[model samples]
Target: MPEYIHGGDVYSHAERYGSLPLDLSANINPFGIPERVRQAMHAAVEDCTRYPDPFCRAARQAIGRAEGVPPDWLYCGNGAADVLDRLAAVLHPQNALLTAPTFAEYERTLAGASITFHTLREEEDFALTERLLADLTPEREAVYLCNPNNPTGRTIAPALLDEIVRRCAQNGTWLIVDECFGDFLTDSAQHTLRAQLGTNPRLILLRAYTKMYAVPGVRFGWCMTSNTALIEALYRAGQPWNVSVIAQACAAAAAEETDFARQTALRIAAERQRLRQELSVRGMAVCAGEANFLLFRAQDTALDRKLAAHGVLIRSCANYRGLGAGWYRTAVKTGADSERLLQAIDEIREDG
Candidate 1:
């Protein structure tokens, strides 16, 4: 059987162990769902009898104010993955460029295209350098980048990113940068390409409230681009009721929680540092990442299963491209949860 590409298998863990695991597998918000967002979702239940707004007007307006983009430049989808499906349907790219070990959803969306994986070297700590520019040729029609990438969790350097955008624009390659996890960063502005978005209509910036708001089940994500033509096409291509009423309400309410977002970022930064220090002190090869999660390597063993015995779960990166056994990704959760995961690993190491 094919392995699960993503994480958060609490259901399976419970089925096996007869209880839920401390699921750090999915890199969701450590604080869990916000009360305001929860209330919004609950309140939205009454609106379910009515069909959702096909255009998601109110939600987009709130998102626009939070993201500093005109709602016209934004297009909502069920989730980032659903938006990606729309992208795949719209842009029939025969040749694509993607980095190794980035988000798996990109490859799934860009399937059937001749994909060139620019492998991020482990020696260089999986950083996307200027060398990727060499692959942004005229033949490559599509490119996807995960800022503070999924498992590695490292944001690409700003200058290198700008050069990539320029190269893609020059080659007329469609560029999609997944900044879903950007909100977890303390200075997400520094790493984002939002400044150049006005000049580059072909550049698609995807963001989601799933991670930061801890509403993965809510399925709220949107993409921003200056290309009005592309926007219309994506909207028309997607279902008229692409985003549910609950999701729209969550998006709008979550956008208004600026103070909540700020506090989460500060909390994540502290926990991430603590996790890094603890992992390194335990002799793990922790990557240099500034996101709400850390990817590290331990001595090759059944760490996932071992941790599971202790009712803990972490994302195993064996299936991710350019990575193999012994590599794992764990979310920087709250102090208690983080402590449980570390304690489990320490016990396992000592047992050996």
Candidate 2:
């Protein structure tokens, strides 16, 4: 069997649970695909006979306009993972620093490149501090940071991030910030590093269309960097026509659907707060974060087993570098789905 990545193990969930129930482990939009994006994709299906635009010109232009970056600085990929792998190839850092329990892909991609890695401890709740910044040396070639960090669901303060960026620039270290979940932030622009790309050549920002658009099957994602040289290296290293025609069309439409994006963000924020309140009222200790997911400690491993038995699969963080059996992460799903999970947890507590 293939190893589990992160989040809802679809194959395992289907096999053990009989059928897929509400999958709250993957942090995707609960509302599913938007009508506009679906329509656009369906319309583009007719062009499948022809090859996709290798350059992704139109999609890149749309992304550039939406992100306020030059089109030349953007490069689309099959998914964020593809871009990450390419980054690993081009940067080829000898030593890298990453937050423990952040997205596992950073380490996996770096490991494949034979890169040495250092992990920040979890006692600080995996938060990046000034002392942590001072520990980085010139030998550490690159640093990967996931804002509103995964698994833990915590965010680094903006000022601290600025300081880190400054330090990285001074030491000639590449700072790659994965803002895959940054769209869920109330003030995305304030927290985003895209605007500073030109001024800080050391910074690379990774964005994804999968999570917010609920289009993981389509695999649409891109990376932005002001260094034209790095962008060229990535483009050359990636396969030709990496993104599909349908994915390109759908991702562009989703990016243009400003209203839908705003509504979804608002809905997720409200729903996340509601879920946190409901869980806390039931005696669960939830970790605070800005994304559309919640991380909390279950009373025991029994809760994990019971939830799985009930067909509600959540991410058990035991496999994460710094987490253990009691750690659990669940995405903010629809009102009904969230209620179902809460009810299941309540029942498990009562039974215990």
Candidate 3:
């Protein structure tokens, strides 16, 4: 398996620091899980003895209604990562293209394939631009685009994204755009490619309940594409009941909480701006992002470990390709949680 050491390792931090730390590592919803979703999961415990619907009919139907996609177009997986793994298995592309300093799972899932990196220059603030269209050559059979890209949290402009999609189609490249963090954006619809799935057989869109619903333990995510044959191949790549009954139930309920998602986007917009300004004033090179997290650089390369001592956890982006040490990512938490995070950083290390 690919390295699973990404983040949200509060347990590991607790073990080493001798105390549980507030996790600002994972960009989970600050509002926590919706009450209806929590209750749905609880109500599903009794149904655990029965086999979950292999097709995820009920969950997909509920999610379809919310996401405005047909249930048949959806392919539920253990998580977005799991869907990506199955996708890699089914496509088995000889050559893949992805952005550097984005999600590492793209590299891990396509490990066997020859990979090409389109480095997003830091001087460009890591934002994807028209320059990327040049890399969509015929030689690359598959491509991964992480919207509001991880670590950088910068999204591609719509016109640029359209051109990239057009280029991918011309090259006959299978395009998988990951919009897992789309819910956190104030205008997520602008960044989403859901409307194109019906026309673009080569396009696939991925979404997850992990970050938006704060349900990582459920390991629930789904991908939507109009390519029926590809969807069938994905099912064959994995075993039956890949998603548990509880997870399906949670996904179904969570999909119905549309207002919850809306409020979260609003709150995240405010909180992210607050943190971005604060971090920049503190002498860090903060990337302007609209997501629920901030990616910034610091003089303290060991900042993550140092914060652990003060009962807080943050992600060190040193392992992310195209980035080096001193780069870090922290979730924009609600209320005083962000205050505590800032205070912890102040206590442990000098600002810049």
Candidate 4:
């Protein structure tokens, strides 16, 4: 079988198409980087000769303030993926549980550590239910969950998720929630587990500025937990200076861009709804996700291929364990950009 793939690989597509394509595969903030963050990044170049602060104290402090947690409770990483890898390594679990049709990275990371994991099915539209609680047995060492889960972009309700966390704690299992896309929700605070960190030592909250700040190139993310020993273990397991000087500075500045996140969420919510409605009207089976992207099943054309032929790039979910051909995902871009994607679909349909 082929290896799991991730989105945002526009360079390879550009190479194949002989030109840059409209990249809708990565669910980034379509509003682009904040002006303040851009300036901070430009200023970061003045200090590249020195090694970055391996502890990431300043960045963590900013994030801590924004998240209302102590800086010592957090650990910085190259990205949320790096944190996931570190968690798997520190825990060294023999067995874990995850959801089907979720982020591919979890499987790859767990497998690398020789950790076996089971899967839970969404059944319809990837909706997670309380039945997930049954899988959190004492035998399982850990569980990986993504809030507003990837590809499908659906979020598990906070009450149910809290119950799951309690069960994991009771069963002596670690619950790692990847809230990478949580910032895109207007009511993210109500859904996030950040507040539970102090009470649930086994709870791991993973977050990233890559999507929310539109700074994927920066490769910055962090995790929070009350398990101070786990945080120390993650630090020792990672190389010194895993986060670059530029990334640290950018993240610190990005934290202060409060209005940026709020505005982006508003914009994405509008565009996502618009795209979902349009695709449904066109007879595509659309998943109305709560995040900044939409997933759909369409047979009108080889959606990914047809869109790519017209200089557009979207995610094909056939490789996802629970899904197959005809399933596609596209990021919620600005009105103009999303309209262009819709037009490409129309053009392909008309051509047939």
User: Per-residue lDDT of 66-141 in model 1, one digit per residue for the tens?
Assistant: 8888999999999899999998899878898889988898898877889999999889998888888788889889
Please give the range of 10 consecutive residues that has the lowest summed lDDT in model 4.
112-121
Across 1-352, the per-residue lDDT of candidate 2 in tens digits comes to 6877677577777876678766888998988898989999999999899999987888898888888889999989999999999999999887888777788889888874434434545556556667667656787789998987887667788898888888899899999999999888777777788778999888999999898888988998999998889988988896888999999998788878776667788888898899999988987778776788998876677676688877787888888877777888899877998999988887877887
What CA RMSD would you report for each candidate? 1.2, 1.8, 1.5, 1.8
| Backbone clash pairs in model 1 (N, Cα, C under 3 Å; residues 3+ apart or in different chains), count | 0
TM-score-best of 2 and 3: 3
Model 1, residue pairs in steric clash? none
Model 4: number of clashes?
A: 0
Give the TM-score (vs. native) of candidate 4.
0.96
Candidate 4 residues lying further than 4 Å off, grouped into runs, are 1-4, 112-123
Assess each prediction's global lDDT (C-alpha) against the native. 0.90, 0.83, 0.89, 0.87
Cα lDDT of model 4 by residue, 1-352, tens digit:
5643878888877889899899998888888889999999999999899999999988999999988999999999999889888987898777888788789888877874434434434455678877677777788888888898988888897789888988888998888899999989989888898878998899999999999889999999999999999999999896888999999999899888778888889988988888899989888898869999898888854789888889999998888877789988899989999889989988988988
Evaluated at residue 248, the lDDT of candidate 2 is 92
- For model 1 the local lDDT of residue 44 reads 97
The backbone clash count of each candidate, in order, is 0, 0, 0, 0
Models sorted by lDDT, best on top: 1, 3, 4, 2
- Please give the TM-score that candidate 2 achieves against the real structure: 0.95
Higher-ranked by TM-score: 3 or 4: 3
